[model samples]
Target: MNATGAWDRLEPKLAATNARVAALESDPSRRNSFVAYTMERDSAYCDLDGERLLMMSGYSYLGLAGDERVVAAAKAAVDVYGTGNHGVRALAGTIPLHEELEAEVARFAGRERALVFGSGYAANVGTVGALVGQGDTVLIDKYDHASIVDGCRLSGATVTRFRHNDVDHLERRLKAAAPTGVRLVIVDSVYSMDGDIAPLPELREVCDRYDALLMVDEAHALGVIGKTGGGIEEHFDHKVRVDVKLGTLSKAIPSMGGWIAGSHDLIGHLRYAARPFLFSAALGPAQTGAALESLRILRREPERVTHTQTQAQRLRTRLNDAGISTMDSTTAVLPVIAGSDDAAYDYATACRKAGVIGLPVVTPAVPNDLARLRIAVTARHTAADIDFAAEAFLTAAAQTGLI
Candidate 1:
C-alpha cells in the first residue's frame, strides 16, 4: 500500500483508541485511571495531584527501593562506572558489576549460572525464542504474566495454555502432546494478579513424567514467599526440579534488569544465542550494584520476608472480616474483587480519597467479572500501616458498594 492508503487504514484505529480513552477519562470514577503520580519520596508512597497517598499497589516487596545502603551502593557505582555502558553486552558493555550481579543471582537462585537481560520482558522473550522454534512447543499457565505469553508467541512455537494452577488440566494437555520435541512448561511461582502460588510440586511431577522442561517465573515470589527469601523451592521446603528459573531485579531486588538462571550449559547457550541479551545495552552499573546490595540485605534479614507475609495475612483477615473477598491470596499481594470494571475503578478512587493507593485491575487484564483492586504489601509497611490500609479499603468498599 502507498503512504496515503496506509494512513487511511491507521487513522481510524487511532481515532477509535482516542475516543475510547476520552470516554474513560470523562467518567468521574475513572478519572484516576492511569493518571501519572509523582513519588515524593519512595515506592511506599507517592504524590497524586498534590495529595500524598500511602502506596499499596507497587511490586517492591522487600522495601529496598529507598534503603540507605542500597542507595549508597548505587551512588558508588555511578561514581566509579559513570552513568551508562556505551555498547551492547556481547561486545563492550559487560562490566565487573554485571558479572558480580549475575554470580550473586545464580548463587541466590541455587543455579550453576545466570544471564542478565535489559528488562524482564526482554529476558522472557529472548529465553523463550532461544529455547524453542517452529517445531517446538510451549505450555503456559493461563494466568501467567503477559511477558510470558508474549515470549511464547515470539518463539514461533505451538503455544498451549492450561487453566491457572490446575495440574490435572495441564497433565491432560501434556498427555495429548506426549513425546514432543522440546516441550516446555511455563508458570509463575506466584500469580501476580491473584497473589496465589502455583502448584509447583504437582506441575513438576507432571513435567517429569512427560520429560518436559519446567520454567518458573519468580518475579513476585523471590522475596515474599520463602523462608530465606529463596522463592518457591524454599517455600515448599524442597527443590522442585525447575529447569529454568526466571526473575526480575526491579521487584524484590529494587533494580532494573532480569535474569535467567539454570545449569551452566543453559546459561552458556543463552549467552550466545539470546538476541535481546546480545543486542541490548547492558544493565546499568547503579542497578547492578543496588541489586547486589539488596540481595545481601535479603539474605541477612530474612525476617523482612516474614514481616511482609504476616502483614499481608493480617490485611487479608481484616478485609475478609469486613465481608470483602480476597480471592485465594496467601502472599504479599492481595486482590479485592469488585465484580465489574466500573466498581473496581470506583473502589480504587475511594481508597485514594481515604488516603491509600490501590490500583484497579480490570478486563481484559482479568476476566470481566473479576475486576479488582490490586494491593501489594511491603516489608516497610508496619502493623499500623496495614490496619490503616485495611480500614481505608473497607471504607471504600462500603462507599462503592463493592463488599
Candidate 2:
C-alpha cells in the first residue's frame, strides 16, 4: 500500500453514486428530460435546447424575479453606488441601502430591528453561533434546513433533534433536557424538502412554557404565507411570536441575502459579533437596491401572495389528481417521494422529459430513504402549464414505473 493507495478505498461509495449518475445519463428519455443549464427567457417560458420547458423549479415564489421595477432599481443602484459595498459591514460595507433594507425587513416581520447577512445560510449560522454557546441547549426539528442544523453544531451547543412537526416530542425534550442557561428552539416555518408547515402555534406554546427563545427560518414561508407575507407566524395568526425570524431575500424578495428580524438588542449584538456578518462582505448595491424594491412591491402588491398560494394549491391538486404522489405540502413546494434515490432522479428526469423542470433532493441533503423530486410552483405558472406538467408527470411516472 502506498500513500495514494488510500484513494482506492473510496471506490465502493464513488462507484455507487457514479452508477446512479450513469443510469440517469444512459436513458434517452431521461437524458433530455431535465437539463442543467441556463436559457433565454421569452415571455413566460424559456427556450431550452430549442424546446420551451415549463420551468417548475424556480424559487421565485412571488414571481418578482424579472420585474421591471426591480431590475431598474438594481441597475440604478449599480450606476449610483458603483457595484460592491467594498468591505465588510463592520468596516465600510454598511451603507444607506443596507440600513433601509434592514429597516424595511424588520418592519415587515413586525420586529423592532433587523440584521442583514450575505445569505440565508450565513444568517442561520451566524445568529445561532452568536446567540447560543457551549452550555446552551438547541432543540432543532429533524426536517429543518441544513443551515439551521449546521448553525446549531457550529454554536457548540448541545443539540437534540425532535421529530418533525411533533409538538409532543418537542415539549418532552424541553422538559427532560432543558438548558441550564439559555434554551434556543429552532424550526423552519415550512419544511423546505417536504413543503409541510411546522406546528407554529404548538411550538410557540411549548417554547413559552419552557422559557426558551424561539427562532424560525422562514425561507420557504416568507413569500408564500401570511396575509402580509410575514410567514408562519402570520399564517398561524400568532400574535407577538418568534423571538427571532430569519428570512431570505433571494426567494421572495427577488434579490440576494438573508436577514434576521428581532429586537434592537439582538440585531445590535449580531451586527457586532456574528462571524459571517462581521467577516463577510456585505451585499452589493444592486442586490440591496433590488431587494428594497421587491420588498416595496410585496407590501404594495399583496395580490402577489394570493396568486402564489392559489397557484401552488392548483398545481398540487392537479398533480395529485394525475395519480402522482405530492406530499402533504400546503406551500409553494411539492415533493414527490420516490422510495429511493434512483427513483427520485428518475422522477426528476421524467418531469424534464415532459417539459417540466424540477430538482431532485437526495442524500445527505435529505435522508437517503426520503429522496424526493422537488417541485416549486411559481405565481407565473399558468393553468395550461400546470396541466401540461401534470400530464407529463403522469406519463413519465407510468413509463418509468414510478407510480
Candidate 3:
C-alpha cells in the first residue's frame, strides 16, 4: 500500500490525539502564546524569522556544543582516523582513540573502569541486560528515562517502579522484592524532565540494606554537578560505590557517545558480553577524540563545572522571582510547568516567537498533568542573556494567562 493509504488507516487514532492537542491549544490560558516556525541559530541565540532571542533549549549545558577546541580535535581525528570505525568494536574497529576516551571517562567518573557505547541508550540497554536476566527484579524510579525502562524490559527482568524521588517508596518496593529475586535499583541522578534530583544517598542506603546493587544514570548530571563533575553521587557527598554509573558524552562533553563506569571486572564482562558492543560499530575517531579533549578540559578547568551550576541557580532564581513555576529544580535543568500538553507546546512556541528556543516536554516523556518547558541552562549564558530569557518567558506567560 501507498504511504498515504497506510497513514489513512491509522489517521483515526491519531486524529483523536490531535483533537486533544487542539483542545488544549484553544484553552484560554494558552491560546495567545504559541509559536509555529523554523529557526536559525547562532552561538547563544536563534533568529525566529526576523527576531533574535536568547537560546535556552539545548543540552549543551557547558556551551561546548560548537567550541573551537572540540571542533579542532574532531577535525584532526577525522584526518588521522577517517570518518568511521568501519567495523564492530570487537572486529577491526577498536582504535587507540577509543581506549583513550574510555580511560578518561572512567577516571573522570571516579571509577576503576569504563566501557564506551554507541549512545546513552545503548549503554543502559547493554549493561543492564548483561547484568540481570530472567527472574531478576529491577526497581526503577517512576520518572526514570525511557532508555532505562527499555533496558529493564530487554533484560527479561521483572520491572517495578517507585514514586519519583520517594526514598520510602523505593525502600518499600525493594524490601518487598528482596525475597523473590536478584535485586537492582536504577535511577537517574538528575531527572531529565522534572528538574528534580534523586535522593541517591537515601536510595543507596536502602539498596544496601536489601543487598540490591544500585545503578545511577548521570546522563544529565555528569558535567553539571559534583565538585569534579562526577554527578549526583558527588553532589550529595555520598560515596556509595555505584555498581553501574551510566553517562552520555553528547551533553556536557559536547560529543556523541556513552559510557558505563564500574569495577574492572564488570566493564571487562560488558566488553565480551554486551550485544550492543559486539554488534555496533566502534566510536568514530572524531567523536572519540572530541570526547577525550572535552574530558581533559573538564578536569583541567573545574571552573567550567562550577560556572554551569551557578548559571543554573541564577536563572532558576530569576524565573522564580518573576513568578514563573520552576518545578522544584536545583540543577542545570529548569522546568516551567505548563500543566497540559497543548499549553506546554504553546508556551514553548511563544518563547520561540519571542526569539528564544525552549523545549516543551510532554507525555509520554512526562506524566499527563506535568507537561512543561524544559530549559537547560549553560555557563555560556551571560547575566544579560539570562535576564532576557526570563523577561521573555514572563511576558509570554502573562500574555497566555499562564502566570
Global lDDT scores for all candidate models: 0.89, 0.84, 0.84
How should the candidates be ordered by TM-score, best one leading? Answer: 1, 2, 3
Write the number of the candidate with greater lDDT, choosing between 1 and 3.
Answer: 1
Compute the lDDT of residue 97 as modeled in candidate 1: 90
Q: Tens digits of per-residue lDDT for model 1 on 1-403? A: 5699889979999999788667645665467566787754344678877778888998889888888899999999999998999798888898999999899999999999999899888899899999998888899999999999999998899999999899999999988873658999999999999999998889999999888999999999999998988999899987666999999998988888899999999999999888888888999889889999999899899999998999999999999988988888999989999887777777888998899989888878898789888999998788998999999998988888776
- Stretches of candidate 3 exceeding 4 Å from the true structure: 2-42, 48-51, 178-180
Comparison by TM-score, 2 against 3, better one: 2
**Candidate 3: tens digits of C-alpha lDDT, residues 145-243:** 998999999999989999989899988887778486689999999889867788877888898899999999999998888886778878888566677
TM-scores, all models, native as reference: 0.96, 0.92, 0.91
Question: Among these predicted structures, which one has the highest TM-score?
Answer: 1
Compared to the true structure, candidate 1 yields what TM-score?
Answer: 0.96
Return the TM-score for candidate 3, rounded to 2 decimals: 0.91
